[model samples]
Target: MPYNFDDEMIDEIREKNDIVDVISEYVDLTRTGSNYKGICPFHNEKTPSFMVSPNKQIFHCFGCGEGGNVITFIMKHLNMDFVDTLNLLASRVNIDIETKKTKRNKELEDRNKLLFNINKDSAKYFYENLQNNKKALSYIRERGIDESVIKSYGLGYALPDWSGLLEYLLHKGYKIKDIHSLGLIIQRKDKSGYFDRFRDRIIFPIINNRGSVVGFGGRIIEKNGQPKYLNSSDSPIFNKGYNLYGINILKKYARGKDVILVEGYMDVISLYKYGIRSSVASLGTSLTENQVKLIKRYGKDVYLCYDSDEAGKKATNRALEILKKEDVEAKVIVLKDAKDPDEFINKFGLERFYETMSNALPYMDFKIQLYKERHDLNISEGRIDFIKEIVTELKKIKSPVERDVYLDKISKETKVSKDSIKEELKYLPIRNYKDKYINKNNRDNNKDRIKPVINRLEPGYTIAEKNLLYLICKDKNIYESVKTQISPEDFITEEYKKIAERLYEYYENEEFLFKTFEKVLNDNLIGTLENIYNTQINIDASQKNKVLEDFIKTVKIKKLENKKVALKERLKEIDLMDSKSEGDVEKFKSICLQLINIDKELKLHQ
Candidate 1:
């Protein structure tokens, strides 16, 4: 359920919480004249660039350009939502917001509480059963998990009886429907009564970051059990994609250290037992964007320690792609002579596991190794294809020094000169659209709510449009003057266009405020706004008009260039037709004429 708080109520919460005080909790701050200054928590910086103005009640980081009010700061730092932040702030000041809760929201709140209670009780039941069952104890001890480790992870076991858990929940006054809703019980095929969902399995309670048991993951005791692992179905209160298996422990133990991601519950447990406490699992599912975002909150450097198999490689590749888009750094820990992390750690002991983790491959190097495995570098044709694939991969590398290192490695492997590899990089058609605007609609999909990072290498026109927006934000007269020349449609990037549109709307209503602008923007757009706002543009009063005109012209020119590119692509498609029909010829001619006109317009702008 969604929260419903009026503007006045939100304002009250914001007023009760001071920006400098709120930020001070997370970052050390020193009094810098009227404002507070501290090292930025968002990015790595030695000097103090993060500023909090007491008068304006807002915080800004000159280093990373992340600026927002107290609420935005808490939301981003804690990875929380709008209402949750408000509630947290309100609680600090002893403000009760229950009066503002809607009926539906209140019902959801109560129902979630009940579900959490059910999961807690069910977990206790499973743990008690495990203590009595010698078979389950032997299996756990065989895996090198001691009694202390089991207690720490809240490990449990489910009996093979069909109604063992169902009868227990009923005796405890929990309704069958509610038990089934949490995936602890299943309805009979004949629609009679419910039975236990996890039978003869080791139960691992899936505790979220909040320390609440939201779901369960069950591994069968039988060696040949079908669907070896059983996970609780997603309920209103539990989403496997959103919650990690050992995140609760990771949050408690990982003190600014690297986070290790694994594939299974036993892997995380085994690693934890062997002193690798900074590890978590993906709840028997593939890595998700939300999980990546969650991992980012705890640590920046992520270590992927999945099984050493084909499926694990694919999973690692998928995670790398997502981590790349989210601008998160990742490394791969490939185990030799071991199928998974559990087996590897158990076989080699902790010292060897540490040695292997220290030698983990960077994501790009991992990709290169995968390519090496795929192609036969001994053959001439294989070497050529390998070089081509490596060149394509190298194009994505932003740092010239890092790219040169990889190029040198490729050169030594295939005996290809560095000059030839550089030449190959030049002719490889850059997938600009895919790289620049990948997953633009990811926010629309619930599976991937984390927004992809905006490419810093935007074209000149896009940068100009962003400057125009910044200028408007600095001076209302500039907004009035620029509105007449270019609207939001003129901005090439979707993020820029949306910000422009919001600026227009806010200015029209006379509601533009730097402190409260985050209200209208989502998390990603807020980041975009901070980048635009952090820019220092100094123009003479007499030259302001000229600068604005140049920016407007640059944006318009880019619009024409985009049209020209689309027209050329369409014309090429028409020419590639097997048989050019009369209509196709006419369409091709029309596109050519459009391209010519667009080129002329671009030249005039130039």
Candidate 2:
């Protein structure tokens, strides 16, 4: 059965969830006019092209062409699946979602729960193994790690017996089927019973970015095992690429500070030992897109403190390439050539590593220094090659003044002319300063870009519509004043109708918070609200009535004009049907005349 979503519910949601408030949590929105504008988080746009319409309960970005309601915004911003978005919002609104009794959602939900349950139980079991398990005491002491450090990271151990964990879990009333579902144990091919997946290993729990244990990584203790390390396979809840080793563990320390990005889990632990609290490991995979966003949400800057050996350099360069796209500052620590952070700390101790971090160069400066060492500066062509290489790196920088400063530094290093470097800068594909200078912004250009399309309405009509929605959304009296005489359905744009529909349904709940609407409105409507919020308009008392009347009239005119066109198209359709009876033809003509009369009545000025 289809769950009916009434217009009143939509209105209630919109009134409860203001687009600006919802958007502001994820983005930095600055008030523009009737709406708020910000850099579109959806796409790479330096200029603020994304707008949120509090009035329309929608958001739209001109850059990416994404327009939607609060629900859609949550779906896009959070990267949540649609059902997740629905459930998340439903929970917020105190509305219950009808469970999909279908096999698929049920299977997926159950699989996730089982995986979650396994991770939970496995974490407790692993921690117990670490504590007072006689078999793992030698493994713990060999690392020279104090017991406190072990406990702080929740370090754990896996028992030696092949069926130890499996047997215990079964005794706890977890079915063998459910144990298999958790991916903690595999099916036995040669034997009748199941066995433990990981045996006699030192375990490091893999927690999700949300701080929930989703998987585990195990390091072998016994010399007999050829593979030194093994990580859990992907199940319903975990993707290794998306999961970093210490993001969940070290996020609070990273927040409001620069994070130390090291290569391995031990490097992260070693840094913490050295009083460098803001460090995390990439969990044996390259730093991924999901990882970048996760870090950015926590820390404002990232210090790539990967190894200094050849392999480490390669990893560092690749990390720099990926992290640069996130619009945050990143610096690479080249670890003084001989060893990794752990090796350096073990040899020279913590002071040396802290000095290295302090002396770290900006990534572009480091890239220039790297290429400079490759070419002989004395040779003219070699110097030119070096200049070209460094210039390419420098040109990638968005800030022009910063680019020029580096260009000067290169001029000193390579003896390349500063003017020559500036001339080379012209060819780089970057937005020039004048193009993005927004303050004291030109009225015509800004207004020209802002006009709503009543289906592309001109700036003036957009202003009128924006003001009307603002009034209707924030004040009930304004909504009631127009509700009897004006219909938002008469407004041709889908965005207008959505606002009207919400208003028609809502206007009654006194305790509603407009910010809560993002929970329930669809993405499309959220986007529309964002755009309406972007448009400049007056929702003030003196201009409210006049603007409302003008907007209502414009919508009515558009509606009537469309109706007339439909009538004309209907007559042409009748002509095409040769089998039409004489009575039927007469009736069609009469109905067309009545439609024309109704259209004329609709267009009357308020």
Candidate 3:
């Protein structure tokens, strides 16, 4: 199945970066010939309608009508940045992208690799030390961890000597510069040497779903160390906010069961040890938007088992904020008396931990209880404030049924009438303003792809420009006339110009119009092109001159209109960022006026 790319290593990378494989890493894909199908993971569905294609290297979901290629898949599924998707692909294909001389993608790839390698090497060092070092073994034994558990987690240790890891890595053929740059080693500014950053610690390798060690969590083995634990600094590949310590190992458990989210690695290990397998811990930090997205993709029901300590409760509130954003079904498990799930289990029993997991309180119910804990509800002011807070949050629920249900729960707690709550919601700033805007204008566009603005060329231009361009490539006669008469160079629209350039090159190569163009241009461009080719054409075959003249005129007009709109949008953006007339408002106004003049000129030309 692996096809040789004939020395086009980048091409090989691009080809291997198939939309199916990229998507399958996130979405559970079912094979359907050259294509695969799965339910659209971005949204909920009853039937499996998301389709992925390896041959064409595109994916489309008929249920949601979401469609795109591998890059778009990452952008949508992972909710990653553009450069991040490219870097992920490049890494998969083992491409060595240089940071400086290369383009933005390459530089990002280089930085990403440096960051990943640093974390990986650090994890390897930890694993090695755990296996060979006596002090680390003693530390593990003291903690009452069996050898089987340590080996299961692939745990390791950091030697007492600061230079132990540095020397070992250097001998293993890792570059000293990369080792320092990756934050695996601390380099002295006035000196020329590097030393191990994590010293005399029992190391835990933080793994991702693909099972690559992306970061390290080091526990102090020596009693003299001030801090008990030290985690790797945030890198491009590893964010403490986004990662879970043992999600890679626990993802299998997470897949089918309600996920049990614990606070620490010890908690996860303990839970797993007791056969409560569907448990994972956040990366020595609070839950983040990225982490929420990751968890939501894997499972629907989430149980948050944070430490019973004050800091853990604070972390719980912060995690609640992110999960609220993701709109997931989450509950909080209160681990009473003990510091965390691990200690709680060890102190009480696995039975108690299981009971806590099963009886995890609904996130809102927990928060409501938190409010009750803080305030005396019988007090009129306290009740009023509590009712107001509940109503405010309840109004944020767009679903009427869901809102009413929660309102009923609020009424049961605070003795507030449902009608009164609904009345209060009428005045609350809780409408889905973004959904309203998107619904109004987003009908023509696919939400899966991110386009700042939709195409809005005039009626006279749309049929001819898109049609002639489509037919020119399809039929040789049309291609010749267009090739000699009109070049993309003379087009007014920078967007259409780019489109035309891609078409021009494709036509020049005498390539077929369908799969060839789709492969060359990305999913967005391909969709646009397909729309051009497939959409209803209004012009007759005879009206070449009239169509050309009208197309040219509309293109210019649209360009001017777009420029004016952009100038207006930019002025508003500057106003917001400046928030006052901090920068040159007059300069922005000047551009707006110039845009207006261009519109007038376009009108005259038309």
Residue 103, candidate 1: how far off, in angstroms?
A: 3.0
**Per-residue error (Å), model 1, residue 262:** 1.0
lDDT of 1 by residue, 322-409 (tens): 7777788799999999999999988999999989989999988999898899799999999998988778779889999999898899
Model 1: lowest-lDDT 10 consecutive positions? 434-443
Q: Candidate 2 residues 1-606, lDDT tens each?
A: 111233344345545666677677667789887889998765556999898888777787765556567876786567664446555666666664453234444755676677677778888888987886876877777666678768667778888788888887877767887676445776675658787767778888887766778877777788762346556654446655567777875675657677888877677777777677678877655566667777887776789888776456656766787788666569987777447887777677887777887888888877887787778999998898887777778768878788778887988988878998777756655432222212223433564563322222233234445657755554344666788777766656667677767756755542122334333467667656644533333222233465477666655655665777787777778878879998868968886887869666864541
- Per-residue accuracy of model 3 over 199-290 as CA lDDT, tens digit each: 88777888887777777777776677245666665444554555777777667666766787877778888887777767887765446676
- What is the total number of backbone clashes in candidate 1? 0
Listed in order, each prediction's TM-score against the native is: 0.57, 0.52, 0.54
Could you say which candidate leads in TM-score?
A: 1
Please name the candidate that would achieve the greatest lDDT relative to the true structure. Answer: 1
Return the candidate ranking by TM-score, descending: 1, 3, 2
- Tell me how candidate 2 scores on lDDT: 0.67
Clashes of each: 0, 42, 3
Pairs clashing within candidate 1: none
Evaluate residue 377 in candidate 2 and report its C-alpha lDDT on the 0 to 100 scale.
91
